[model samples]
Target: MSDPHEQTHIDSVGSYVKILLALLVATGVTTAVARLDLGAFNTVVALSIASVKMLLVALFFMHIRHSNKLTKLVVAGGLLWLAILLLLTMTDFATRGILGVPGK
Candidate 1:
């Protein structure tokens, strides 16, 4: 039996090339989507596509997929913090007009 400490995954060059191509395609799609007016959904669609592309780059290009569980947990925690910050920012922006000025 092989030692458990040895590295199990060795990604090939072709996989990296494929990921590059996928990122390029995602960029093209983002550009195309931006050209068409989709009302408020435009932002949703664009962010969704961007999120997918970011995940691909983070998982494959950054070698996060091959990392240990602790590393994965740390990454997940960081993403969670980011989401919280974004949510707070959006909430503040959305509620700006609700507050009335004393002079008004």
Candidate 2:
């Protein structure tokens, strides 16, 4: 049997080129959407596009698609930590009370 540790699942040049083109198109879509007046939905749209781009980069460029389960778990943990931090920051801002002058 072949060694389990041997590198496999190599991609072709065309695959890389396709991913690159997809990333470029996603970036263009993000730029165009940013110029619109979607108001509250604007953030949602931008984040969605960004998430797609991030996934493409991670799966293709970073080789996360072919990585082991342990590596995937580590990446997930990092994302969870980031989410927790953002949640705490937003909570702090949302719960803050306005300050006023003592003697106005």
TM-scores for all candidates?
0.84, 0.85
Best by TM-score: 2
Backbone clashes counted, model 2? 0
lDDT of each: 0.93, 0.92
**In candidate 2, what are the lDDT values of residues 1-53, reduced to their tens digit?**
66778567798999999999999999999999999999899999999999999
lDDT digits (tens) for residues 20-90 of candidate 1: 99999999999999999999999999999999999999999888999889999999999999999999999
Summed backbone clashes in each candidate are 0, 0
- For model 1, what is the alpha-carbon lDDT of residue 1? 71
Worst 10 residues of 2 by lDDT: 95-104
* Displacement of the residue 37 alpha carbon in candidate 1, Å: 1.1
Give me the runs in candidate 1 sitting further than 4 Å from their true place.
Answer: 1-8, 99-104
Error of 1 at 64 (Å): 1.1
